[model samples]
Target: MTGKTALVTGGSRGIGRAISLRLARDGVRVAVHYGRDDQAAKQTVADIEALGGEAFAIKADLEEADSADRLWQAFDAEASGLDILVNNAAIIAPGPFAEQTQEQLARLFAVNVQAPFLLVQQGLSRLREGGRIINISSGVTRIAWPNDVAYSMTKGALNTMTLALAKELGPRGITVNSVAPGIIETDMNPWLADPVAADAAAAYSVFGRVGRPADVADVVAFVASEDARWMTGQYVDATGGSQL
Candidate 1:
C-alpha cells in the first residue's frame, strides 16, 4: 500500500481497527477514524507506527446530519488524495422484535446507511481513478437474523448501495464492493465469545472455525487491491459459508 492513502471509519477498534492496521502494514498511509474512542484511536495509530507503518487518528460522529461535512473537512486539510475508503463504522443495537423502537431504527440507519453513502460521495472527487471502496456489511442481512431487524435492514441497504455505486463508479475505474462477515470475536458483539455465538459462528463455516478480524480484513484488502479490478458491484461473503 505504499504511496496509497486510506481512510477507515470506526478504525478505533474491532474489524475496523484490523482493517486500518492491515492497510498501514501494507504500506498505506492510514487515517484512523473514531466516533468517540479517542484513546483507542490514538492507540491504533501508535500500533501502526510501531509496526513501521504511517498512520493518524481523526474523529467524526458520522451518524449525525452534519457528519459528512465534518469528516471531509478533517480530511481536506490533513491528507492528500485517497486511494481507499473502508466504510466500517456501524451500530449493532440488539433488541428483540417486540422491543424494537423507531428511534433505534432511525439511529441505526443513520450510521450504517447514510454515513457511508455520504462518505463515498464526498470522497469520490479525491479518490484516485482506480481507487477502492470497501463497505463492511454483515451476514445478518442474508440470514435475516431474528431480533436484529434494523441492523439487517441497514446492511441490506448497504449491499444494494454497493452495487449501485459500483455501476456508477466503474466507468471512472473505481471499484466498489461489500464484505459481509458472519460473526467475529470482537467486543462489539459482547455475545460473540459466548458458547452459543461460538457454536453458531463455527457452524456457519465449512472451514470449522469462527471468523477473525484479520480474516475479514484479508479479504477487504484484497478487494481494495488492484488485483480485484475485475470484481465490483458484488457482495463477497467473507462469512465463510454462513449464508449458504
Candidate 2:
C-alpha cells in the first residue's frame, strides 16, 4: 500500500478513526474525512504522521449531495487518484421504531446509505483499476436487535449495495464489499458504557470481551489491501460471532 491513497469517511473517532490509522500504518497515504470534529480528525492525521505515515484530514458533511460533490472535487485536485475507499460514516438510534421520527430514519439512510453510494459513484472515476471499496456495516443487520429497526434498515441497503456494486465494478477490476462489525467499544455504542448493555454484549459474543474499534479496523484494512483482491460483493463479518 506504499503508493496507495485511501479515503475514509467519519474518520474522527471510533471505528472510522481506527480504520484510518490501520491503513496509514500499512504505508497507505490517507485522506481522512469527517463531518465535524476537526480536532479529532487532525489528531488522527497527527497519529499517522507520528508513525511515519502520511495523512490529511478533509471535512465534509456527507449527508448533503453538494458536500459530497465538493469532497470528491477537493480529493481529485489534491491526491493522486484513489486506491481504496472505506465508507465508514454512519449513525445509530437504538430506540423503538415507534419512537423513531421520520427525520431520524431519513438521516440514518442519508449517512449510512446514500452518502456511501454517492462517494462510490464519484470514486468510480477516481479509483485505479483493481482498487478496493470497503463499507463498514453493523452486525445488527444479521442479528435481531430489538428496537433497532431503522438503523438495521439502513444497513440492509448497504448490504445490497455491496452485492450490486461488486458485480457492477468487477468488469472494471474493483472489488466492493462490506465489513459488518458487532458491538464494539466505541462511543456510538452507549450500551457499552452501561453495565447492563455491556454485560449483555459481552455475553452475546463468542469472545469473552466485546469488540474494539481495532478489531473491525483490522479486517477492513485487510479487505482494502491487495491480499483480499479475490474477495468481492461479500459481507465479511468481523463480529466475534455476535451474529450467532
Candidate 3:
C-alpha cells in the first residue's frame, strides 16, 4: 500500500480513527475526513505524522445534500487520484420503530446510506482503476434491532449497494465491499462503561468481550489491501461472532 492514497470518511474519531492510523501505518497517505470536530481531525493527522506517515484532514458535512460533491472536490485539491475509498461516516437514530420520526429517519438514511452512495458516484472518476471501495456497515443489518429499525435499515441498503457495485465495477478491477462490525468500544456505545451492561454486551460475542476499534480496523485494513483482491461484494464480519 506504500505510496497509495486513500480517503477515510469520519476518520477523526472512534472506529474511523483506528482505521486511519492502521492505514497510515501500512504506508498509505491518508485523507482524514471529519464532519465537525476540526481538532480531532488535526490530532489524527498529527498522530499519523508522529508515526512517520503522511496524512491530511478534510471536512465534509455528510448531512448536507451537496456534501459528497464537496468532499470529492476537496480530495481533488489534495491528490491526483485515489486508490481507496472508505465510506466510514454514518449517523444513527436509536429509538423504537413506532417512535421514529420522519425527520430522524430521513437524516439517518441521508448520512448512512445516501452519502456513501453519492460519494461513490462522484468519486468514480477520481477512483483509480483496480482501487478498493469499502463501506463501513454494521451487524445490525443481519441481527434484529427492533429499537433501531431505521438504523438497521440504512445498513441493509449499504450492504445491497456493495453487492450491486461490485458487479458493476468488476470490469475496472475496483473491488467494492462492506465491513459489518458488532458491538465495539466507542463513543457510540457509552453504556459499555457499565460493568453489568458491558457483560451483557460481551455475552453476545463468542469471544466474551466487547470489540475494540482496532479489531474492526484490522479487518478493514485487510479488505483494503491487495491480499483481499479476490474478495468483493461480501460482508466481512468484524463482529467477534456477536449475536450468533
Question: lDDT per model, in order?
Answer: 0.89, 0.89, 0.94
lDDT of 3 by residue, 180-238 (tens): 99999999888889999999999999999999999999999999999999999999888
> RMSD, model 1, all Cα superposed?
1.2
- For residues 166-243, write the lDDT of model 1, one tens digit per residue: 999999999999999988878887776578767876887888778889999899989988889999998999888875
Return the top candidate by TM-score. 3
Clashes of each: 0, 0, 0
Worst 10 residues of 2 by lDDT: 188-197
**Candidate order by decreasing lDDT:** 3, 1, 2
Stretches of model 3 off by over 4 angstroms after superposition: none
Residue 176 in model 1: shift from native, Å?
0.5
Alpha-carbon RMSD, each predicted model: 1.2, 1.1, 0.7
- Per-residue lDDT of model 2, residues 1-244, tens digit only: 8989999998879999999999999999999999988899889999999999999888899778687898988787779699999999998877976798988888888888889888888778889999999988888889987789999988889999999999999988899999999888988877678888788889978887899999999999899988998999999999999747
Positional deviation of residue 129's Cα in model 3 after best superposition, in angstroms: 1.0
TM-scores of the models, in the given order? Answer: 0.96, 0.97, 0.99
Q: Give candidate 2's error at residue 40 in angstroms.
A: 0.3
